[model samples]
Target: MKTLLLTKEEVDGLICMHEVIGAVEEAYKAFNSDQVVQPDYMGIHLPSPRGEVDFKLGYNKANEVISMKASSGGFIDNPTAHGVPNGMGTILLFDARSCALTCVMDGSLITGLRTGAAGAVSVKALARKNARTVSSMGTGNQARMQIRAINEIMTIEEVRAWDSHPDTLARYKTDIESEFGIPVVTANSKREAVEQADILVTTTRGKGSLVEADWVKAGTHIVAIGTDQQGKQELDPEIFRNAKVVVDSMAQCAEKGETWHPLNKKIIAKDDIHGEIGEILVGKKPGRENDHEVTIFDSTGMAIQDNVAASRIYQNAIDKGVGTFFEFFRS
Candidate 1:
């Protein structure tokens, strides 16, 4: 069997913001329609200075995609040392009917694109249609991808960002403004960045809240994407309480996502959450009940998203005649 090997650069070349947003939207619809089979993610904390290892696997029957990914949390210690990313991963794509391996693609870009697209999906489902201003926290690759995804779903006129590192924030402002043809401004503080924005996306991995409740406006839609694991936080707990919260997966959000932080602190009760995004997508629940209502989409990053996105990329690569072929299985 010929296995397709796609590098991160190739994967990046193959995907665009519009395509990723559409793919993730399809995945959300499939998930809401009860067509995907996803299992609880399993994580293992390696006893090492290297850090924890995480593995997640899932299949989407409607989209005919399966994905398995693993990441080692060590590369961030010295990002420039190996000319590679801190979070490295690989996604295995399979034939849904035959359950045979079809391709192996770089997972780092897949992770960023899918998660960014997920944020876009949330924006589409929850944000006001006329939302034109965006505020982003963090200046990492994920933050860049998130801006790309946001632009795909909305006609964002301006972008504001703030980071601990001034150099990174300055670079982000210049690069994003040049790329997106939108005004990008660097803020002095997280509060300054988030305040007066129509949409806010928190993509930092800070262990404490960088977003405050008061900074967010009544009609702002907030997407918290950084806290996909326990102990990670980005938004103030009071923001969650004031806003009607929608989660990708409530069960997982309770354990590892942004909601976990507030829940543990007794800031917001479980029932206070409106519903899952899937439920809202399926029409089982409502989204953005009123423009004045502060809406939040707590994204923890789900396996179904990975499966659907990787599967789409694999098929696209095949159709476009991209990726290197090797005989992983031969007669």
Candidate 2:
């Protein structure tokens, strides 16, 4: 048997935002139609401070592919101590019928792109048609990808951003302006950013809520992407009280994502959730019933995202003859 091995650079070259959005959107539709099987994300936290590893696995029956990704994060000392990134991951792809290993590839870049694409999908389904002003919290790599993905679907006349690090915020402003030819405004506070946004994206890794419910406007569509862990939170619990809450995965979000906080506190019940993004994609449920409605898309990264994304990248690599192929097993 031969297996394909792809590096981060190879994967990045093979995948683009346009294809990623389409692939992720299809994965969501498949999930909504009961054509995918995904297990709950599993995590193991180290006793040492601020370190953990998690894995997500799923099978896309429609595509006849199975994927598993194991990733690690919150190792803050890695950069200073080891001169390496704080987060890293590996993705494995297998044939559904024979369960044979088909490909092994870098998953870190895939994770960021798929996650950004998920936010873009929500923006397409929930945001108002005329949304042009975007507010982004956190000027990190994820924030950059989020904005790029949004620009793929919306006009994005202006961007307002806030970050605790002034240097990072400044760089974000310069980079975005130079790349997109749009004005990037550095906000003094999170509220300022939220108030100026037609579409708001929160990608921070804060431990507590950085946004207030009162600051959010009625017609705003917010994509809360930072709070994927138990203690992480980016939006106030009150935001979910009256907002049309759409989660990536109800079962996973109820346990660890942004929905967990509100659900655990009884701020909102299971019935309060509008529906999964997949349901919205398949037209099983409505999205953005009115412009005056406040909508929130709580994203807990899903395994199907990795499955579809990896599958697409794998095929793209094969078609383009990008990645190296090696014979691993002898008959």
Candidate 3:
């Protein structure tokens, strides 16, 4: 039998931000509702080159497909030293019935969008209905993706941005204003941005706390996008202590995500977490009970997202007659 192969460009053309957001929400629902079986994820570290690749494997009973995603990051010299993106990935999709490899595709776009959508889903579930200001703490690629996904679900009157790199910050303002047609203002400092935000998103690759608990005001909903890896933190643990914290996965976050730091520091106990995003989406728990309540969503990313997204992309390719087919066993 032949296996389908899809390039990154093809995959980008096949799915939009809106569709990716919907698929990610479905994945979360399936995962929290006990329809997805996720195996333990594996990470391989490379010390000399300073890079890491993580493998997330799972079976989506809801979709009747098995999927594995491999994402590589931390190649700090890729852009200036090399011509390609620092992060690259590949996803393998297999048939649940026969366990046959069905398709192979570039996983970078899916990985980016799924994570971006995860933040959007959290905002949709927890942010106040009248929230109009967004403060983005970083001006990287993930920052752009998060803004795009969130714009699909909310009305943003203004976007306040802050970054350590002045050039990157300036470019972000130009690109976002041109693309979204919304006012993008550059903040002089992180506190200046965080203090004025109705919704805040942190997308920096930092190893220290970036946002202070006191900087965040009441009734704000924050999407903590950084701190997915061990030893990386963006917000003070005190922030977690004061807010209604929701994680993408309790087990994963407790060990590696933002939830882990707060636990290690004894600032907040495990019970302090209100619930997982899936739980909130499935109505097993409440979200944003009142406008005055402060909420934070710590997203470490998960496998169910990859499974559902890859499944959707594969099916769409088949329906649209896209991708290349080659015999995997060319005997």
Candidate 4:
């Protein structure tokens, strides 16, 4: 048996934000149509570095995309102690018809790209169609990817960014502004960046809340990508509890995402979460029914998303011979 190996750089070179957004939208549609099967993810904590690894596996039968993903690494103690990244992962795609290994993709790039695309999907589904401004928290790879994905979907004229590190935020502002052709501003505070923005995206790994409920407006749409961990949170859960909250998966949200702690504390009930994003995408439920409704998209990340996006990029890479080939078994 032979397998195609895609390095991180190769996989990064293959993905585009627009394509990823399309992939996410398609996955959600298939999920809503009952064409995809997914299992709840499991978490494993690494002892030495004090981080957690997650597993998400799914198959979209109609779309012919199958994948299992394991993402880990968060050595928060030191910035550059290891030569590797703070997070690392890979995607293994299997052919639905043949059950054969189709591709092996670098997970880090896939995670960032797919997560950003999910944010883009939420923005498309919930944000005002004519929105032109976006405020983003955190100045990392996900932040950059979010800017790229959002820019692909909307005609964003300006992006405001905030980070605890002043120098990093400055560089991020310069780089993203130049790349996306949007004026980027560095804000003095999270509230300053969040308020008055048509759309806001939170991507930090911080454990404390960054955006408050009062700072949000009537028509604002928030996409919170940070609070995927049990103790980590970036947005006030009151905002989520009060708004028409949509999650990637209700189960995952109740277990690990922003809704986890609050749910455990009984601040939010099972009925509090409106529905899955797939339901809204498939038109089984309405999204943003009124202009005055505040919407929050809680993205904990999903495996079906990785499989769908990775498979698409992998097929393109195969046709272009973008990655190296190796044999896994010899008969």
Candidate 5:
């Protein structure tokens, strides 16, 4: 049998943020309903370049496909040193019945889109219904993707962004304002950005906490990204003491995500976790009970997200005849 192969650009052309968001939402439903098999993700840290490679593998019974995504990022010098983007990855999709490799495609773009979609999913379910302002930390690739995805789910009246690099923040403001036709401004400080947001997104890679607990205001929904690995702290654990914390996967997040720090430090216990995002989506639990309470969605990323996304990409490629096909297993 032949396998389909697609490059990053081809994959990007095949799927968009809106489709991926809907797919991600469906994936979470299957995940909690026991229609998907996903193991906790694994991460390997590199000392030299200060990077991380993460492997997410899963099987979707509904789609009858298995997939694994290998993604790497955080190499600050990659643009100059490797002549490549900082984040890159590939996805291997297989047929469940035959256990044969059916598709090989670029995963980096999917990774960014799925992640951005995940944040939007959380906002749709957990954030305030009237949220019109979004504040974010770290204006990079994922930041752009998140803003694009969130705009699809809600009407963002304005966007405030903060980055340690003034030039980066300025560039992000310009690019966002130009592309989305929205008011984009640079925040003078992290507190100024976050406190003003009905939804606060953190996408930094700093080893220490970036957003203080007190900086967060009531009714604000925080999406904690960039904490998929151990020791990556973006929000103060004290926030957990007051905010209703929901995670993509409790088993994964307790050890490797934003929830890990608070659990280890005794700031909050496992039982304090409100529920999985899937549970909220499937109506097993409630979302944002009151407008006055704060909420936190700790997104460590999910294998189910990768599985559903890859499956959709493969099907779309086949339908559109968009990629190269080769019989790599031919005798």
Candidate 6:
């Protein structure tokens, strides 16, 4: 059998933000229809102050493909010590029918793109039609991708951003303004960013709540992206009290994502959740019924997202002859 090997650059070249958003939206629809088989993510945590590696795997029955991703992060000193980023990931895709390893690709870019696409999907389904201002609480790669994806789906007039590092915030501002021609503003505080936003995004690695409930407006839509692990929080638990909370996966979010804190502390119950984003995508449930309703999308990241995105990229690579193909075994 032959396996296609793709680098991060090659994968990036194969995918555009609009295509990713479409693919991720379909993946969510498939998931809601019970056309996907996904397991909970498993993680191996290193000692405190270090990092952790996580494994996420799933199959899209509709697409007849399976994928597995191994991702690691949380080592703050990686850049200084090893000259590498704080996080890294790789993806493996296989044919379900033949059980053949069809592709091996860098998953770091896929991770960011799909995550951004997930937020875009939520924004499209939940955010108000007049949501012209977007706010982000981090100025990193994920934040950039989130803005890019949102720009593809919605007409964002202004972006308000905040970061602990001033240089990072400035760079994010410059990049967004240059690439998308959208006005970018640097907020002096997180509260200022949240209060001014019609659509709020939290993509930080902080382990505590960065947004308070009172800071959010009634019509706001929040996409929480950073709380994919236990004890990592970005939104206040009280924020879920009167909000229409939609999660990527109920089981996954209940255990690891932003829903965990609220569910754990009895701030909210599972029944309080409106539905998974898939349900909204499939039209089994409604999204953002009224403009005055506060809505929150708790994104924990899903393997099916990776599988669907990788599958799309793999096919694009094949059609464009973008990646290297090598024989791994001979029959």
| Candidate 1, residue 56: lDDT | 82
| Model 6 alpha-carbon miss at residue 118, Å | 0.5
lDDT of 4 by residue, 290-311 (tens): 7778888888988788878888
Root-mean-square deviation of Cα positions for candidate 1 versus the true structure, in angstroms: 2.0
lDDT of 1 by residue, 1-331 (tens): 7889998888888877788787777777777788878887877765544556678888888767677887655545546666755668888887778677888888877778888998988998899988988988998888999898888877898898889999989899888988988998888888898886898988887889898888888899998998878878898888988888999888889999999878998988999999888887778888887889899899987788788778777878989999999876766
Per-residue error (Å), model 6, residue 224: 0.5
- Give TM per candidate: 0.93, 0.97, 0.97, 0.93, 0.97, 0.97
- Flag regions of model 4 displaced more than 4 Å: 48-50, 76-82
Worst 10 residues of 3 by lDDT: 43-52
Task: In candidate 5, list every pair of residues with a backbone clash.
Answer: none
lDDT of each candidate versus the true structure: 0.84, 0.92, 0.91, 0.85, 0.91, 0.94
lDDT of 4 at 146: 89
Cα shift from native, residue 132, model 2 (Å): 0.7
lDDT, model 4, position 29:
81
Candidate scoring better on lDDT of 2 and 4: 2
* Candidate 2 lDDT tens digits, 118-155: 99999999999988999999999999999989899889
Clashes of each: 1, 0, 0, 1, 0, 0
lDDT score for candidate 2 against the true structure: 0.92
Superposed Cα deviation of residue 27, candidate 1 (Å): 1.2
In candidate 2, the residue pairs with backbone N, CA or C atoms under 3 Å apart (3 or more residues apart, or in different chains) clash, namely: none
Compare the candidates by lDDT and give the number of the best one. Answer: 6
